[model samples]
Target: MEPWEMREWYADYLDACNRHDFDAIRSFVAPGVRRAHLPGGADAWVSDMADLFHAFPDWRWRRIQLVVEDDRLAAHLRGSGTHLGVFRGVAPTRRHANVAQFAMYRVTNGRIAEFSGSADEVELLAQLTGTDR
Candidate 1:
């Protein structure tokens, strides 16, 4: 896909995420795609996302910027959500946290073939726990 087309596709994916449409999300990822922290590949990745929904039912992400080259995409996103369930061993604080995330993905035939990257978990923890770090 051209860079513009990739961006459009990625924007639609983000729309799916913001909508918490897991079924739609599945279509964007190739079956058995690997992720370091999660096993079961694409299913696990989607499950992890479900876990996040449980923790923060209103979680939403907004794109800060995106860069695409060939089949690779780099995304910078800002997210915000209200904690409603346990996550990362932290009990619900009923707090809202805003965080930045950076993710890199490789798309093949329009499905994500590889996914990697992270969000500001430390900062999120600090905000939720009400502690200086």
Candidate 2:
């Protein structure tokens, strides 16, 4: 796919994520898609996303920047959500949080084949835990 096409595809994928549309999200991923920081296949990634959606029903990803090179794409995003359900053993705080995240994706045959990302976990934890930090 061309660079612009990849960007469009990624934007659509992010929209699916915000909508919590699992079927739409799956359509963009390969059956064997690998997650670098997680152990398991595409199903596992979907499950993880489901859990996240459950915890933060209004979760959204806003693109801050995007860069495409060949079949790889890098995205910097601002993720925000309300704590409406249990997450990581923590009860709902009913507070909202905005965190920065950087994700790397590799596309193969027009489908996402690999994904890895890092978020501001410490800040997220602090917000969830109601800590001053």
Candidate 3:
């Protein structure tokens, strides 16, 4: 897809995600889509995102920046949400956390083919536990 089209698609995808529109998400992901985490050996990004949204039902991502080149889209996103549920083996603390992530996604046939990213877990943990870091 063209650069403008890719940007537009990503914007829409994020909007759908924020709204928790599963059908829109299904339409955005390729049938063979694969999601991987950065730093290697991490769990699938697709399932991770799903689990994350489940843990923080009010999560919202604010796009800080985005870069599109060839078939790749890189985005810097800042997210904020309340800790209203358990997540990743962590019990509910009912706190709030803010996180920033750098993600790169590859698009094919107008759908996301792959995705990977990194974020600061230390701060997230601190916020969840209401402890200083």
Candidate 4:
């Protein structure tokens, strides 16, 4: 896809994420995507996202910047949400947290084939737990 197409595609994907539309998400990710260290596939991907959604019902990811090269896309985003449910052993703190994340993705046949990223979850966790990381 061209850079403009990729940008539009990425924006649509983020829209799906912001909407927490798992069905829509399935359309953008490969069946067996390498989202985690291992290939978890779209179902697993949705399940993981469900977990996050459960913990932060109002979670949102806003695009800060995006760059496209070939079939690869890099996104810088600012994510914000409230700790309303348990997350990775951390009980609900009802605290709001904002974090920065950078994700790199590869697209194949117009679907996300694989992706990896780093998020400031440590900082978010600290903010939620009232402790420094």
Q: Per-residue alpha-carbon lDDT of model 3 for 58-128, expressed as tens digits?
A: 98889999999999999999988888778767887777889988888888888877877777777787889
By lDDT: ranked, best first: 4, 1, 2, 3
In candidate 2, position 120 carries an lDDT of 74
True lDDT of residue 84, candidate 1 = 93
TM-score of 4: 0.94
- How far residue 69's Cα lies from its native spot in candidate 3, in Å, is 0.5
What is the C-alpha lDDT profile of model 1 across 28-120, one tens digit per residue? Answer: 999978664657477888998998899999999999989999999999999899999999999999999999999999999888888888877
- Flag regions of model 3 displaced more than 4 Å: 37-47, 131-133
lDDT of 4: 0.91
- Count residue pairs with overlapping backbones in model 2: 0
TM-score of 2: 0.94
Candidate 1 global lDDT = 0.91
Candidate number with the higher lDDT (1 or 3): 1
TM-score of each: 0.93, 0.94, 0.84, 0.94
Kindly list the per-residue Cα lDDT of model 4 for residues 1-133, writing each as its tens digit.
Answer: 9999999999999999999999998999999788746447888889888988999999999999999999999999999999999987899999998999999999999898998988777988898899979
- Report model 3's TM-score to 2 decimal places: 0.84
Better of 2 and 3 by lDDT: 2
How do the residues 1-133 of candidate 2 rate in per-residue lDDT, one tens digit apiece?
A: 9999998999899999999999998888888898886865778878888988898999999999999999999999999999999988889999998899999999998778998999777888798897977
In model 4, what lDDT does residue 94 have? 95
